[model samples]
Target: MESKRSKYILIGLSVFCILLIGITSFKDGFLNPLRSGVGYVLSPIQSGVNRVGTSLYNGISNYSTLRSAMAEKQALQERIDALVEENSRLQSEQFELQRLRELYDLDQDYMQYQKIGARVIAKDSGDWFQVFRINKGSADGVQVDANVMAGGGLVGIVTDVGAHYATVRSIIDDVSRVSGMAQQSGDTCIVSGDLTLFGEGRLRLSNIAENGDLKDGDRIVTSNISSKFLPGILIGYAADITTDQSRLTKSGYLIPAAQFDSLQEVLVITTLKEEEAPQESTENTEGAQTGA
Candidate 1:
C-alpha cells in the first residue's frame, strides 16, 4: 500500500512539469527563464558535433586528391621515357643516312673505275684499321690484291678474299710497303709502315732521290711501279724530308690522306691490273694442284 502511494506522487510531479512548460510556451510566466536556460545550454553541444563532421569529410576529400596527383605524375614520367627513346632512334637513322650520301658522292667522283661499295664488317683489335674485313669477296668481283679506297684516297689492299668477305691490309700495317712518289717532283719513295711511327700518324718514306726537291707538305701519291695498288692514288702529304745515313737516298714521314682511325664503308676497284691477273690465276691453279 505504501508503494502505491509513492508511485502516485511521482506521476503528479511529471504532470506539474508538463503544465509549467505549456505555460512558458504561452508566455504566461514573466521572463520565461526555463526555456531560455535550456536553449543556452544545448547550442554549444550541437555546434561542436557539426564542426567535427565537417573536418572528417574534408580530410577524406584531401586524401582522394593526393592519390589522384600521384597517379598522374607516374603516367607523365612513363610518357617522357618513351619520347626520349624515340628521339635516340631518330638520331641514329639520321647518321646512317648521312654516311650513305657521302659514299654516293665518292662513287661519282671515281666514276672512271668500277667500284662496289661494301661496309666494314670487322676491324683489327688494334688502334688502327691495320687489318680489317669488308662485306665483299670473290663473289662480288673482289679479289686478293684488289685496291681499296675511302675518304678520297687509297686505304689498303685486299690481301685475302673468301666467298663473301675480304680482309684488307691497310698501309698503316707494320708489314705494309707501298711505292709512292712526290707529286711535285716525281721523286720515287717507298712508304713503309712502322708501328712506332704510326702511333704519331706517320709512315716511313725511303729510297727518295736526294735531289728530288721533296719538302714538307708535298703531296705524295701511289707510283705506277706499285705491284698491287693503282697509279695516281693519293697516299698522303710528305713531311720532315732528310737525307738518310747512306746520303744517296732521302727519307721522310708521310701523313696518310685516308683516315684509318674510322673505316665504315669502302670502294673496291673490280678490275685487277692486266699484268697481275695472269699471275693470280697461276697461283690459284698451283695451290689447287698442290692440294690434290
Candidate 2:
C-alpha cells in the first residue's frame, strides 16, 4: 500500500505542472496579473545596473584623456626650453664674431708691424685697465716695451714679462707719458696720463708749443721721437685746448681712442723700438770708422 501511494503522488504533481503551463500561455489568462507584478519588481534593478556600467566606463575614459594631454604638454615644454638655449648660444657667438672682425680690421690698418694676438687675463684692482696682464709672455716673444694696441688705437706697453704671462701698463696710468703729434699739422705735444682727469675720459695734454696749430678734434698719434711707442700709432683726439698761465706752452685734454674700462684682446707688436737702436748705432759706427 505504501508503494502505490507514492506512485499516485508523482502522477498528480506532473498533471498540475502541465495545467499551469497551459493557463499562462493565453493572452487573457488568469496569471497575467502575476506576471505584471513580477516585471514591475525587477525593472528598477535592471535600469540601475545599466546606469552604473555607463558611469564606470566614462570615468576610465576621462582619466586616459587627461594623461595623454599632460604628456603632450611636457613634451612641448621641453622643446621650447631647448630652442631657447640654442638661441642664446647663437647670440653669444654672433657677438664674439663681431669683435673678432673689428680686431682684424685694426690689424690691417697697421699692417707694417709684425703682431701677435694676446687676451687680457688679469688686471689690477681698479675700474680702469691702468695695469693688466696678458696670457702671452716671453715664451711667445713678448718683450718689455712691446707696444700693445686694441680697439682701433694704441693701448699700452708690456712692462714686465714671465715665461707664460706678461704685465701691461696702460696709457691711463698716472705715471704714463706718451709723446704724441697731431696727424693733421705734425705739431708735437705731450700726453700725460692722470687718473683723476680720466674720470671724465680724458688725459692731460701739455708741452704743446705756443705756435703749434693743433686744435680741437685733431688726431693725435705716437710721435716719431717717442722712445718706446712706435711711430704713427693712434693715441686719441685733442679737446678743450687752452694756453698755460706762463704763456710759454698750451695745455688741454685728450680723448683716448682705446676704451680703458673694458680691455679684452690686444695686439702686441713683437718688434721693439729698442731693437732698431743697435742696428742704427752699428751703421753709424761703421761709417765713422770708414771715414777715419
Best-fitting candidate, scored by TM-score: 2
TM-score result, candidate 1: 0.72
Which residue pairs in candidate 1 have backbone atoms (N, alpha carbon, C) closer than 3 angstroms, thus clashing?
Answer: none
Error of 1 at 138 (Å): 1.1
- Model 2, span 84-182: residue lDDT tens: 999999998997787678789889998988899999998999899998999999999999889999898998888898999989888888877888899
**Considering only N, C-alpha and C atoms within 3 Å, which residue pairs clash in candidate 2?**
none
Output the lDDT of residue 285, model 2: 12
Name the 10 consecutive residues with the lowest summed lDDT in model 1. Answer: 283-292
lDDT (tens digit, per residue) of candidate 1 on 21-71: 998877846566877787799888889888888888998898888899889
Q: What lDDT score is found at residue 64 in candidate 1?
A: 89
lDDT of 1 at 192: 83
lDDT scores of the candidates, listed in order: 0.80, 0.85
Total clashing pairs in model 1: 0
By lDDT, the best candidate is 2
Give candidates' CA RMSD values in order: 9.6, 9.6
